[model samples]
Target: MDELDLKYALEAILFASGESVALQALARAIEKTPSETRELLRELMEDYDRGMRGLRIMQMENRYQMLTRNEYFPYIRNIVKATPASSLSQAALETLSIVAYRQPVTRADIEYIRGVQSSSSLDLLVDRGFVRIAGKLDAPGRPVTYETTPEFLKLMDITSISEMPKFEEFSGGIQLRLEEQPEENGQQ
Candidate 1:
């Protein structure tokens, strides 16, 4: 709406994009010409620089992105970097099995399948660098879906997820036993 509003909006958009956005595309999104958008970006860059902010905007070739400053990388790395988990607990293993097999599945679905709350197990899988939040479902509430990361593939010594044993192998045995039960409700 106003120039101040536009500036704030651009800041939020750049942060959310998490990747470079072309100047032309950003202008179109904000209903401004390329030149106008470029000027606004410069002003924003200067503002961040003047304040010595830990996060700054960078122009990567023809696009722009907001990222943590190089000076702070050491701290960020200290916080973010970690050794991958060497051993998985039983719950974590179970959670990983579900994610690997029913990939892009949600926390709710995982809990339902396992018949218990599994927040901690899921947390361990994520912190251990095995599973990741793939994306959100389009349905209401936008539940986060999960999938195995490349690290998991490499650790499991597999080239692709499809190479894993069939999901039916994990589920079919249960179904068979249930179906094998004799009918008694109507007395045959």
Candidate 2:
């Protein structure tokens, strides 16, 4: 297909899916090599960004998704009569941070780090699609492990976990000291 046709085909796929489209899938659909498809996606993304358009394309890892720019959310919400998105609570945010950084982590590990029970916060994160059960740990009893989802990346406006700010960059004021807890046998 011609360049313009290829671009329009990609745009149509993105708009119709309304979800992240894998690079490979896009390439297959457009009958182009992955590199060529990536270049095309880059061009499309730049076109959207350079223009005063309400829509934007987000690249998450090897996937691309078309979405409305955050700046237009207020107007869209007004028109759609959608309730304002709720902000995460401090506990939930902390829980999410822990999961994002230390996944696949278990509930015990999270509670140990926060020095507080995090069941409710974890549940809320799961319910909101920000966190998911990656698998069960290999330790005794096989505790379920959690990890951040693509939705988490989307909320953070990041393409991948590697794009997250280095922990040391923001760790100066934070200190975590693990205290020994007595076991059921009363041994610490």
Candidate 3:
């Protein structure tokens, strides 16, 4: 391979190695044959050793990982900024549950089910990356539809929505009809 081609291949491998670099993904990214990429990587690893760089390429569990030479982690962490994480409220949790169960539902539908306006709660869900606007529904008037994101699955620790708790069987106390209340015709 030429110098430019090899440089691009090396850069792609390094960037992908930040996470695990699978051979197929690296091949697709580099648009080259997997065998050639593997050879290039071996050469790069050898060059890295001969240059005395503080980084190394490693193969583990059928994936490649590019990491600092272990002696440099403390220096790296000290230079990075740290921020405190925030917690979600009970209201947000309930709203999230409703969205998770009834998506791709609209914001109005969520409000109707919760018996309250949910603009703020919808904003919170979107901000936290759990819910996303799937697209507008194709009904009489188009209303934005929302669905739980893959991030939601990750946060909830589930591989799929089928694993969610069954809410269909829970009957009654949830549906309080307005008309069922006793008539208040000036009765004490």
Candidate 1 accuracy as lDDT: 0.78
**Local distance difference test, each candidate:** 0.78, 0.87, 0.68
The list of candidate 3 runs beyond 4 A from truth reads 1-84, 169-188
RMSD of 1: 14.5
What local lDDT score does residue 126 receive in model 2, on the 0 to 100 scale?
99
Supply the global lDDT for candidate 3: 0.68
Regions of model 2 farther than 4 Å from truth:
173-188
What TM-scores do the predictions have? 0.47, 0.86, 0.50
| Model 1, TM vs. native | 0.47
lDDT by residue for model 1 (7-89), tens? 77788889999876888888988899889888888899889988789988876434777877767777877989844437888
User: What TM-score does candidate 2 get on C-alpha atoms?
Assistant: 0.86
In the predicted model 2, the residue pairs found to clash are: none
lDDT of 3 by residue, 52-159 (tens): 678766653234556566556666668876333477777778788777777778888888878988889889989988889989989868999887875676556444
- Identify the candidate with maximal lDDT: 2
Tens digits of per-residue lDDT for model 2, 84-152: 789999999999988887888899999999999999999999999999999999999999999888788
